[model samples]
Target: MSPKKLFARSAAMIALTTASFSTFAEEVNIYSFRQAFLIEPIMEKFTEQTGIKVNILFANKGLIERVKREGELSPADVVLTTDISRLVSLTSQDLTQPIQSEKLNSNIPSQYRDPENQWFALTTRVRNIYSSSERIGPVDITYQDLAKPEFKGKICTRSGKHPYNVSLVASVIAHEGEANAKVWLESVKANLARKPQGNDRAQVKAVKDGLCDYALGNNYYLGKMLADPKQVSWAEAVNINFPNQNTTGSHVNVSGVVLTKYAPNKANAIKLIEFLSDDVAQQMYAEVNYEYPVKVSVQPSKLVASWGQFKADTLPLAEIAKQHQAAVKLLDEVKFDL
Candidate 1:
């Protein structure tokens, strides 16, 4: 070939290579409600395996509205959050797409994943109660027992309106029906030492302050308290109890993800979801956050298993999604404020 022609071809090839590299450097934007520290390791692993950078926008609130406002211009390729109701809201609003992956199907149980596959449970946590070891004699067991007259003015919980508590209420309504659940909530509320005004961790703090005998909380708070050197005393003050073991077992919730309906990189999104569902990634999620791995084969961390095996209410989580409206109504009817 002529020298001039060869030079021209080489210049074009170099230009194309540079352009491709620039595009490759761009990140996969994610709207995640999870704190970065909790999920950053998994993101790093994903980047290492696929060379696709992840840019997370983490917030505790307003994320859903932000995504909706972005409309067709939204840059998010995925959304990850910590509850079924939130995921269902996204799905019902047409914000996400149903995804299919053999690995995800095999790893996550059918009951935990959406029947239509719009979202999936990446990990789970059981809602349980913790009590002051010294103050509460004879260690009360079931969630129902908290409402007994004996425990009045000695209980602590986060606001009833919080999604965690709301979902728990919804689960009760599902199992025991609205009338009974309302009565239980009323009795339980009467037992509160103070008006519900704090987050779960704060309830643990209240327990330490001698303001309450028991605090309703998810299991991770205990793990987090134990893992933190500063919070060791708080952990010491509270004894974890897996509630309702004699009957319905503890209430469970999840941290899950869904594919954006208009994801610019749909194929890559599915690949990412499937990768997160795999046992390896699932285990990392569980360990990092003290959540239960969605993969059945992965064992719970020693700390979690030490609480003892308890039957989880096997009610399909999607039912909770469908009943979210009813849950909200009941929360209002019961005057559970935050």
Candidate 2:
């Protein structure tokens, strides 16, 4: 089916063919946490290069639960999700199985792929600090700096429990240990311009609206906001800062994929995974999603490169994943979002 036609059917159109059942021989079913718009062009390119058909079911939640419920009957040949924590959760749930592909191993960095090969990060994004161009001027900062008395009532962030913040917090725990991370979390909360209350873009808008001087956000959202007519001013109002360049490097996250535990179209799924890991598709993933490709050979988009590249935190994401619960509890303990 054409990309337009595939999109027209949407999630309602995905056929639930079990491993024991059959739908289309050359087709693969994707259970994606990512929106269809982001993947359609890449899927189109995949189809153009290979005769394989891609069917998608896009969901914001419950994909893992659904897969588990379906057991071997699940039609999901692949699962694509954002955030290492979600990938870790899926692996812990046993919804995914390992894929030992040389192409995947060669293309994706070891730090971004599961040690067990259950999931591979397709692209990366940095958690960044957006400084007001007018008020802040040039700035040098770190994740730890957000806690200082100088920044009190000057920082804007979303809920501390949100995955992005949690991941950063988890990294702090990984680096500083639980006790120091607790103190840091409290200090960060003490610095909030207002109660933690919105998404990453909202933090940027807070900077624009003069509600705050420093906002915590993702680097790619700068690209997204710049491209959005309504959000362009927000992007313009702040200078994107890749934090911790002088320290341990900025925290990085990924949008990744996994082969399902019982992928009916295993061959096609592997082909899809390999396609995404290569330069062409990695480029597509970077440009389309405003993210950094996990493949070392693929360059980030011009807009992203304009943000000034820095060393991504080399801490294995798995280590951060392990501290997620501790980070979330720290958020609750600090009442960071309250």
Candidate 3:
């Protein structure tokens, strides 16, 4: 071939290679347990500001198993999930890698992140008690109060095995010890208005229907319920109460993010995590989902703020993660869902 032709061919190859490299460098992939609608806006904002493209694969379950199956070949760069159980599962299964980011450490409180930096919470929600507006009125309550005999046949909740309830039970075990936690679990079960059934919103609906006088639920669900036209009345029928303000404080759980063990875009993944922890994304979380921001400087949305502030238990999430299995065991021992 002539020298000119060879030069032209080399130029074409160079352009193709550079294009591929640019595409590879500018994108990050996420395996998310959060629904797309709930997080997509913040991700879009991140992409808009940083010029890095975001790709998300959303699912309600099985993401951990999927990543395990994919192994080192996994395309996942980040994993976003709710509850400490899922976070602990990722670390315990060796599906995540520890990250050391000054930005993350500074933005997130120590209690809300893994000590080893394997996972970081982006948002928190209280495991709150909802009382009938007409029947109970606004009242101070505690986790221990639900077990009192007067509350028998007056309380409603989702299944105890659910991550939210499991985490709440784990917090109890952390504070009250395994033996006492079991007693608490048995008593709470005995007090159930009916066998534990349905999601947190359903429990609130039962309250509206007068099937129960009180229900246990995550705080954000109140925002969600009120926003949804069909569910608005359910939310209106009850007042959200943060439990244990005078004692151990409300049990708080988080929706958090982790860097994958074999992230194909590690730098971009870290950037995304940091972005989520920053004020922009944190504010979106507060406004859109009615969750408490993990960043200390960011405040809750006006509506969420209207619920009235109360103390959140300062127990480190690591301790709650440690007691997770024992919490599940206690639930089973007492046949909590049965």
lDDT of 2 by residue, 1-338 (tens): 57754443343234444222234788988888988888888999999999888888788898888888777667678999999889988999988989989999999889899988988999998999889999897577898999999998999999887888899999999999999999998998888889988899999999999999999998889999999999999899999888898989999988899999978789999999999899888998788778998999899899888777698899989888899999989889988888
* Candidate number with the higher lDDT (1 or 2): 2
Model 1 lDDT per residue over 1-338, tens place: 47875464445334432122111234566778888887788988988998777766678888788668655445567899998888988888888888867878898999899999989999889898988877763364988898799988999998888889889988888888888888888888888899998789899889999999899999888899899998888888888888887788788999999888866566767777888888768878777788888888998788887777777778889986676777778778877663
Note the Cα lDDT for every prediction shown.
0.81, 0.87, 0.91
lDDT of 3 at 179: 95
* Model 2, global lDDT: 0.87
Give the lDDT of residue 314 in candidate 2.
95
Better of 1 and 2 by TM-score: 2
Q: Cα lDDT of model 1 overall?
A: 0.81
lDDT of 3 by residue, 130-193 (tens): 9999999888999999999999999999999999999999999999999999998899988999
Give all TM-scores, in the order shown.
0.89, 0.93, 0.93
Model 3 misplacement above 4 A: 1-23
In model 1, the Cα lDDT at residue 71 comes to 56
